[model samples]
Target: QIRASVSDKDLDMYEKWNQDYGSWDIIEKKKKRVLIGAASVGIHHAIFSPSGDKVVTMFKDNEIAVWSFETFYCLYKISIDVGIEAFPSDQESIDVDITLPISQSKFQLMQQPLCFSSDGTLLVIVSIVDSSLFVWKWNEQSLHQQIDIPLFKEANGFNTPIKQAKFIGNTKLIGIVSSIGLFIIVDAETGKLVYKMPKTVLFDFVEFSKDGKFLSGVPSEDPKTIKLMNLKDFIKKKLLNYLRNFGEFPEKYRILIWRFLLRLPENRQPFQSLCDKGLHPAFEKINRKYPIKSYQMIKTLERVLSCLGHWSPLFAECDYFPSFVFPFIYAWPILQTFFASHFSSDEWAVLMDHIISEDPSFIYYLTVAYIRYHRETFLNMKTIQEFNKFHEQSIPTNVKMLLKSAKKIQTSTPTEIDIPKDIIEPFKPIPRSPSAYPLFSNYPVKIVHFQKKVRDKIRREELDFLQRKKVLHELSQLHQDIETDERKWIDYDNKVSTMMDEFWDKLIKDENDHQEKVSKINALETEQRTKLLKNIQKVRQNLVHQSDAFLNKQKDWEFKLDTARASLRETKIVGHEELQKLIDEENEILK
Candidate 1:
């Protein structure tokens, strides 16, 4: 299905364009043109919903509006919140207040293709401005979830930004493409990453097959080849074949090849026309959007425009406009004059196109290669003018130098460890008894090893402190319970003793009264004395049993308290040792 934005207000659908030549000849009859929303806000991207009942379009104003496929009437208007006012807590926010909407240039580079699950239940939108993924429940009319794309640590010990993502309807997985050229698969429901291909490639806008068996996209190295591989079997043979011939190919062809590879729409105008009509509009849009533009910002933008003046007119309406220009402006801000002087307008366009679609690893490799090639020159440069002057050299020479130098960089092997004579002597003689062994027996022998071990020790100390803090808090609570139990036991004991004393005192008074009445009635006095004796005996037995049980319980609690105290003492000792070790290491380093 071919959906073309003919004008700002109209979108033309050419359903039978690919079927027959007769369909193209009678374009008016075959195509259906529908007016969509306002003409002022140009449509940036549009896609048919999975069900084919509705059309979703992203506008220049960053509004995502939905239109009925049959009627072309506006259904839903949702404004995309690309940039957040507050930064993520895990990250330290920049001092600059980047509250303004995302720039068209940036949005163009970072904007992801609109995607929907097969069931039409979920809609996913990726925002590069805030590095977040917004997923909507289309049928339910509510947001399903939104997740921030965190900087993922790469093999080179640096973080890479996520570039694009596509949904795999069959497997319930989302295919994520990173700027560094890695394919990542994540669970659609849970949002947890399930699989990440170690192999890296320079590709954009990946999509699943209609049957959901294979994934396909353009490769930067070979634009003509539509790279298709089974989702389960992502082999590197096809990608490696293209890489093998990458350096041997002519520089001019590389860009053109990339354009073909990306399947970017070919709507080229002359270089002069682009500068005259397009550059100023883009600049004016940028200027108006950002009210507080610094002189540096204006100057940087002008440099970009000046470079664009050399390239053929490619407007936002053109496919791959963002992918073509964004990378070059970003990667080499000061090398535009060099590029214009070296290559023709068409060649420059190709070069820009290649950069956006180029493998991220290769980009990193090229950067390292360039640094290696010009290390001495860069080191000798003193001022900004000197640096700019360096860029004035022919671009081909720099490019060639990097390509050649990168080949010469050999991987280094690990060095062998040499035992010190002083340390070797100590290990030569073994102690007869384990108890007589030196305290430094298991310690690091070499100074470098010792330093590393000491650093590790410090880190371990921090972890230990955190663990101890939690344990100590728990111990404090336990101690409070023990104190409360002890108090209860004391109170119980006092209550039992008071009751016994009161009973004994009353029994003794009654016995004295009965003795006085002994002469009056012998039989009644005997019976009363016997009952009092039996009661006294029963009370004594109960008191003895209660006292024994309380004592045993108290003993058990005391044992537990002792064990806790011992553990606390051990923790304190280890803490002191950690501090002492730090002090000793510092003193040794100073000496």
Candidate 2:
């Protein structure tokens, strides 16, 4: 994490120009500068902003100070993104490595922690309060915009808190969602869940391979190890050729055959390591023992990864290695062999689970089969597209009516206003006589009040939005809170928690010396100094008690609001039917 190329002494020149150590007048349209410093509250806690322009000694939530790169001036204070629901399409990547100072008072923590994207465009931050992620873009002079990615919200479903995230292969993000054991994956650009890694799951740190062919995660798990994962792009480009032409399948079905064809792989180190270890037995036989197509093409790609070191002993060992790798590379159809060898279907299912444990993608094919095998268990997995495909020759309507027969209602009044349905078929309209009508006394009156209450509902939603987003609203609340008795908590904590201890001790020493000078002190200066000292003292006192207060009260409202917000998204998309269901569920809950 220490990326400095210059010595601390040599870094000092750029330090002042970089970080606004003293009074700095930052103006627009000037040459940029760099700065470096440590966070305030804790010792050894450091933060260097983008370009090393200005480093905040301490973090402050809601309001953040930006230092000008050129004039070394501290710029604007800004708020964070809140109440947003969208993909974080942009990135702000900068080096924002932070370790907490020994003390909590280390300059105030800025809304927890945040990181920049590789391109220095997207900024990723987390809301520890709600356990959600927020991303923002860095525009010239200030923050561009923001997107909120609330990973999941289903009550029955599981979500892992994102401990750390790193971008891999430009498009994929190797993120650790440390909830279920440790979840790691190459999250694809399209947002479809991509490579889910087991060994990489426990990786606390990850680095790309030298040639960028693989993303490697150093072990954070027991049996301390390393996981070298190839990019899907290279795997498909180089390895798929071997899977396709080398393997054989008796089945004519392309999807089914493709699955079997992926198994034929060389058992030796160089070529076999290039394949998925747990390949299908049927396919492995066709490729390793007798390749249907010459491997002249793939050897070149393997050499490319080796820096074209074909003569290297490493390649030579891989070029000719053992052929015996149990179950696989054996010249036979394992599944058929098992059935003929007397294993029952139930026994076969149990056995296959272990055999395919190394290659989990086949689990999807099994899942689809399970869905078909048990028709009544799961209903929603079949999407509208699939339903339409079966009824393809003709399209089905999005709606259907459930009725054996239809019924009509007849409203009875003393007199009926018979407006015939057919105009031309009706008898020539008979002239009405006032006397025959005979309604001089009172007429049947029906009055109903109908109103559409829209604004009230919208107003109510706005209140809910504000109430639910306390983390996002912190910036707005800071100023008001600072003016209250609670501000004492921050002040007290910062005083003791921060380097203000030195200032405090100095003041205590000079209290009486300054008291003698109090005779010379103007009323305003005396009042100001006394007020500053008292607030500083108050901040330290509160730091002592605030943790208990924060812990007990933070989760009271924060715990469920994120779930509420996520459900709100579905209701918004699904419209009336789903919204109506939402209404019924709430009413039932309230009851």
Best by lDDT: 1
For each candidate, the alpha-carbon lDDT, in order, equals 0.55, 0.39
Clashing pairs in 1: 223-261
Residue 470, candidate 1: Cα error in Å is: 76
Identify the leading candidate in terms of TM-score: 1
**Model 1 Cα lDDT, one tens digit per residue, 1-591:** 334322222334332222210111133444444342234445556666766666676655565667666555556555444321222432222222112233343233345446777777888776655545677777765677776545455557554666777777444567878776667777667775555565646665577886455888777567687888676434223232444556333464455445334433332333334344444332444445333336675545544564353332233222333334433433333223324444444445534443334433333444566666668888999999998876665444345454445434312212242222223332122222322222332333465355545655765786699799989988998999999999999999999999999999999999988887885578777888999999999999999999999999999999999999999999999999999999999999999
For model 2, the superposed segments whose C-alpha errors exceed 4 Å read 1-64, 82-113, 140-159, 172-174, 177-192, 199-201, 209-212, 223-225, 233-591
